[model samples]
Target: MAEHNTSEERADDMQTQQAIAVEGLTKIYGTGESRVAALAGVSFAIDAGEWVAIVGPSGSGKSTLLNLLGLLDRPTAGRYALAGRDVAGLRGAELARTRGELIGFVFQSFNLLPRETARTNVELPLVYAGVPGAERRRRALEALDRVGLADRAGHRPPQLSGGQQQRVAIARALVGRPTMLLADEPTGNLDSATGADILDLFAELNAGGVTLVVVTHDSTVAARAGRVIEIRDGRSYERDTVRATPAQVAAPRQLQGVLS
Candidate 1:
């Protein structure tokens, strides 16, 4: 009984410190013979302010776990808590609201509106939250400035370089002031040089206390994170938990050629 109480207390403490926590998370598609388990009994906890990378080859369940972490999908059976709130059962408007309020996502494709300016793109989440227009613009500009894109706020997606468009996407993600940033293959669309720059930006943001969780198959990207969660065969394990130093982040292997 004492041990049980202690375990429960520890879990409560973890909930206080963790940005994300999942236990026995499972996802399945179809039924009976056609059933495929994308994730099977995966569990992990990420503390607030930690930078983590989720890595796996194609069909390794990394993307499936990311989708769950981002609240884009629900698990078939498991417990998930986001910032201490039990989110496993939320649906419809409540789920959407929880997702928008607690998490921000950056995608490989730099999903920005081609017709909107950078400032407008960044202001989108605020618009969804029904923030006043003046405040939305102000917050959007602030977020753009954080990503070092303030000068290009008036530029549309087509006018920006691939790297710049991604930076704008990052700014949009940050504008929501989410508990954590969830990035799926954030550097996949950029050249090595530009990707290195974006990685540096991620390092900078992590240094400034923004919690980040990046999903990628790139070993170089994973090495830059403080922890690496490697998913395989529908399960995940901590592959490494060595916090990367600034020097290490600055000179990742992909940047070697550029630096040389």
Candidate 2:
């Protein structure tokens, strides 16, 4: 496995070291008196298939960064390259098309249609991509099998438990086989055990070489990632990569006041 990874890294280096590259990225809202800077010269690179976690307190530029990376918002200044192609300037139909083809997103809220079954919900992305009905079912079923949800494919959101619903959302994200999976607080709505199960699924996907960038405030969630990055006040606190196992990063945050 180590040798295989080395070969893959060599191949990646032969092309480019970055899967997603951002340089001097900035985002500003409004103008003059009402203007606010969401991102100020933010820059980062995520290598192909790297599991990176973005952690920060509320109002911290976590969501802002995710939006830019996910192609949901355009940057005010600077450059962003996705898979070696310049995407910062893409607009209108071209931008939307590129995003649809290159990115998959998972959210804290399952975001599944409550009225639809899991299989149907998972098929929606392929449907938008214009895949034929037969092919869409094939891919969606494959994705559900990968996430261990094939047995529950017919269950509606209301009929399934929280964890099962999140798994369905993951199946939908995977059905597209996108270049990157961008998740925003994916386990925020679940109880601890269920959230851990979701994190375990992420770990499995990362092991299979899916590029993952997760934005989360939960320390336990952050611990599951291969690399953890902290953002504070719209700026990075520690840019250096630190090597730590899940056990290391999971140390309980020290409490300052009386216990409950």
Question: Over the stretch 41-145, how does candidate 1's per-residue lDDT look in tens digits?
Answer: 776777888999988778878777888888988889877777766786688888888888888899767779999999999999899888999999999999998
Q: How many residue pairs clash in each candidate at the backbone level? A: 0, 0
TM-score of 2: 0.78
The RMSD of every model to the true structure, in order and in angstroms, is 10.5, 9.8
Per-model CA lDDT versus the true structure:
0.81, 0.77
Leading candidate by lDDT: 1
User: Lowest-scoring 10 consecutive residues by lDDT in candidate 1?
Assistant: 245-254
**Per-residue lDDT of model 2, residues 91-196, tens digit only:** 8888878877878888667789999989999999888889999999888889888777889888899999877888888889888888789998888777887688
Q: Model 2 — which ten-residue stretch has the worst lDDT? A: 251-260
Report the C-alpha displacement of residue 12, candidate 2, in angstroms: 8.0
lDDT of model 2, residue 42: 62
Give the clash total for candidate 1: 0
- Score every model by TM-score: 0.79, 0.78
